[model samples]
Target chain A: MTAQIIPSRTAAEAALAEIFASAKAGLPGSGAVEKLREESFAAFARGGLPHRRIESWHYTDLRALMREALPIAPAPTRERRAALRKAAAALPANSLVLVDGVFAAELSGKLPEGVKVTSLSAALAEDRPGILESLAAAWAEADDAIVSLNAALMRDGVVIDVAPGASLAAPLHIVYASVAEKPAARFSRSLVKVGAGACLRLNEMSLGAGGRAGQTNNALIVDVGEGAEVGHTLSLTDTRPGSLRLETFLVRVAARAKFDSFALVTGGGLMRRQIFKLFAGPDAKGTLRGVSLLRGREHADTTLFVRHAATGCEGRQAFRYILDEESTGVFQGKVVVEPGAQKTDGKMLAKAIMLSDAATMNSRPELEIFADDVICGHGATCGGLNADQLFYLETRGLPPPEAEALLLEAFANELIDDIGHADLVAAYRAEVAAWLAARARSETRSVA
Target chain B: MLEIKNLNVAIGGRRILNDLDLKVAAGEVAAIMGPNGSGKSTLAYVIAGKEDYEVLSGEVLLDGENVLELSPDERAAKGLFLAFQYPVEIPGVATMTFLKAALNAQRKQRGEEELSIPEFMKRVKKAGDMLDIKPEMLRRALNVGFSGGEKKRMDIMQMALLEPRFAILDETDSGLDIDAVRIVADGVNALRSRQRGFLVITHYPRLLEHIVPDTVHVMAGGRIVRSGGKELASELERTGYREYAEEAA
Candidate 1:
């Protein structure tokens, strides 16, 4: 397994320390939360940003991916901000629109009944301190550098609360559209707190629309309450078709909570680290499915971490990628079982199909277990379509190119078939098939 | 007519077929009985234009045209078909959709319009029934997860749909039971016409009894060293390719 993260950023480090110092100096609190934040900030100061040396962040080299200057906070133009509204409107569910790391309330649609949606800004104004404090407590340790950096850079996000016994008819779609110039990195933070026995379906669309700098990143945090079920599907990519994006999603499930997530990635010039996480609670379920179809200079990275912290919880992750031309893909999934988290079942598999020699894929699937009674496994496979299989199709008279596309489609079909929603599955299948067909045509044209 | 004249082939720098020769007239079925490594399957693949099954020498002529210049689909459009012994189990390529594509491709090459969904369904249903394959089989990925017999039957069903002028059955009877063999043989017999030819390649001679060939050739050491009437199959059935292989060497 190759490690891609390294830490040596003095400039970014100085910026982080100043941000933490301000956060400590201007503590917002009604109770002991201020002291906790001070302590977490101190830990952050000591640990600094996590490098690849830390086992948790093996594949995604955040330090290298950051490259040049981190774009300072800036308001994207109103003209370009239309993409946020447009994406939100296309969704068939209640939407929370966030533009350039800031939520646009008047631009968003009406919230569904029994759904309590509040901006992070509004929640802080009322001094409901525990919600924000608990978030820092659960996800960040001053020792956890990335979480602290996110905390320091955190801006406007939506907080969704589902009342007890409520089940949403339509899934909630949170559209985060980045309007910043090229290299615009939008830090989008979302916290979903579902009440016990509540069921919710959420769709997330992460778009780096028309950004010049070529990269945008968003961070989302979701917590499924006890016995609540949440399904989140993300159609993630950049608007410019050849732009790069870095996104991180942190999801936590409570006792009896169920979480299902699907990520369909296309058209990112350089995509880094869309992470799926399940901080296990008793009987909690987490299933992650992702597919990245990239061509040209596009790059997609899917990294998953599922910590089995409670007993009888299930964690499953599957990611497949198709890369043509000079596109690149990276998939790294790790499943960890804490001691006494027995009966924790986990399965992670990463499969990649490279259509051209110029395209590249890096995959590492690993399992860490401390509990003896757990059933945990991981698999990673990378290759082109099987010649024997293709020959079989060819003899059936599907030419080589068509046969190759059919086999690649079949690779994604396995994951698509597992998606419970029929219509959504069909749409994704059609989209992926078309993407593969276009590549097939291009290759054939070049050959001819 | 299909003819192989001094066909020489190799794979990964090693010779598999050397100076091979055979012929099958239109409307006639010829059975090639050979032992493992006798290049029977290699011959079929070379004719079908499988990647890396290079033609080092000799020529394969179909209807008086050298076939070595054609691609797989081109060969198929030119009235040549090779029924793979080990049918690929493609996961997403629906059996019926693939059949339609193959059929339509051949039709388009012949200047005919593509089949509509309804027309395709009707034709596939008839062909499926003739091969004793259920309609559900057509809905599934082409031959994926199918039994060996089912895979062979699906191959025959596709062959029936294409209705090519020449067909090569490479061990189509290798994995089938007596009943599946009979059903497959009956389907092929039903589709036989004076304008088409078939070269059935198999290790065992049992298949020749039902699809009784017009001629039998014993292939050994990559070439056919013996040819005779249909009764030759019974002789090889009692003995084996060992004698013929020794004679060829």
Candidate 2:
């Protein structure tokens, strides 16, 4: 008889399993969705947390890094919701706010015309037509344990629908805020649907207080309709030192449609942002760019899977990482050109700068071109700041800190400039500047 | 005024400068002419506090205060400037943005207020005109994709804007055509004042013809072998550096 031995689970894995078992019945979703959750949890439980052996999660061993999963946070109270509403009032008037992964309608703003917003939990409970199928289909090709866990536990998130041919002048903003004072966990999944010929700009912002130590798993699924133009930008700021965050961006671009997304991660304890994009129809264009500023033993990983599934499509993925202190950054990008995806033009580049002796960066850019008549390439570069450039700037009277900041800014600006929208560009720039300023202040304090 | 006393420098344990003593008085344009491998560029870099070389034993003084202890930017705040032979290309940093940052940083260090945008632009325009640095060039990334001549011209423009008390032009004419050298020389001459000092490092005598130096020093084997008037440059051009090399040996 052959012995069937199971590997031991990490503390986090055990905690996650117990939490799921205790909360499964109360989790928002109908019968089918509940069954899917059970199946997804089974899959996750069988695999355990992603470890170094898993090729996709090679650089980030969640099993080892995640010591224990905190209990899932309950919905915010009235006072917390009121505080969030007051805070939301300070934001732009077109924002939808979520607190601890749960939708807070009172804290949200008035969305633009022709736009319908619903809570994802509500959509799941009501068994809204096509919601279950769409949610189940996202990242279906990749058996990612984290995504499955999120699917099994996702409580609430904003679901946005833009009508066909509707053109919105201002960008719709979605703010995911974590306000827990103690250790906790939040799982949220947002879905965005843009109708054919529609134009939409969506900006997602993630904010957490510096004192809160928690775990957050968030996913954003976007479907760009035929001939639609969509731009999405995500900015994550003020991450605490003991926190952990994993975000997923799953996108599909349709025929002749254009989809562009940029993510700027300034501060995080341990962060992994994974992107899965598919060129679903011919002549669609997809561009993904990101910049990560990491320091203080923080680790940030960006993994991408871009599939050119149709002919005449174009895809570009570029990312930059600036690491300081003992921080580590990882970029693993894979581009797949399908057999029938002829004339597919795709390029991927990852660049990193190590600002200290201990900073580390791992870059792996892979291209799988099954199609013979396609153009695909990938490149990676990792280095320290140019000494000559620093000397040149110093001779021009800029101090070392300022010179370094300027160089880092210039390094990230290449991708930031490609964001296209002027106001959004300014906002992103301001955030970059703010991060630089904080670094400078801390450096000064350390020196003193 | 800038002074180097018994400046002995080395890199990777190999001596590059040996007891090199030189001075550039305020209002004087002193030229250092040297053969290849004579450490002229090393001297310029050492004075500017570039971290590559080891200062075995020396003192770099600006206004009688030792500057070897100061950082490169601190020395710049003290009105020291080095025009690189090969200006570094900093991608994505617009020329205008760099200029403003440099100028304002220096000003702030001197306890002076920053220039207004209009005033800063006016100064850039006036200085850039002398160097023929087009407005569009200033809009592009700093020195990125600039022709060799354009990079040198931009260096000269930065020199003009910063208005340092001591300026060292390290092979500023190396890759320039005659016209470019003339334009850059004109920019340097326009910035000359009694409060300013200049140290021009070059191998050939061509640039000296345009910006005539008040004093010329022939550097060989890391030390100044001969010091003379402007005629010395022409003499070196005619005699070549072989004799000086043999003399220093």
What RMSD, rounded to one decimal, does every model reach?
Answer: 4.1, 2.3
What is each predicted model's overall lDDT from 0 to 1? 0.76, 0.91
Instruction: Tell how far residue B144 is off in model 2, in angstroms.
Output: 1.8
**Which ranges in model 1 have alpha carbons more than 4 Å from their true place?**
A1-59, A70-88, A140-144, A181-183, A207-215, A239-244, A274-276, A441-448, B105-112
Please list, in the order the candidates appear, how each scores on TM-score for chain B only.
Answer: 0.96, 0.99
Cα displacement (angstroms), candidate 1, residue A433, comes to 3.1
- lDDT, candidate 2, A1-448, per-residue tens: 9998898988889999999999988899879999999988998999999999999999999989999999988766666666666677788768888788888888787888989999999999999999988887794755588999999998889899999999999999988877775678999999999999999999998655222678999999999999999999999775778889999889999999999999998786899999999999999999999999998999999999898899999999999999999999999999999999999999999999988999999999999999999888889999999999999999999999899999999998878888999999989988888888889999999999
* Candidate 1, B1-249: lDDT as tens digits: 888899988999888887999989999999988888888898889988888887889989998899899878778888888888887777777776677767876777667898889988888888899999997888888777899999999889888888889999999998799999999999999888898899999888788888989999888888888899899999987887677777767
Residue-level error in angstroms, candidate 2, position B34:
2.9
TM-score of 2: 0.94
Q: Best-fitting candidate, measured by TM-score?
A: 2
lDDT of 2 by residue, B1-249 (tens): 788899999999999999999888999999999899999999989999999999999898899999999999999999999999899999989899999999999999999999999999999999999999999999999999999999999999999999899999999999999899999999999988899999999999999999899999999999999999999999988899999889778
After TM-score superposition, what is the CA distance of residue A62 in candidate 2 from its true location, in Å? 1.5
Q: What are the interface RMSDs of all the models?
A: 1.8, 0.4
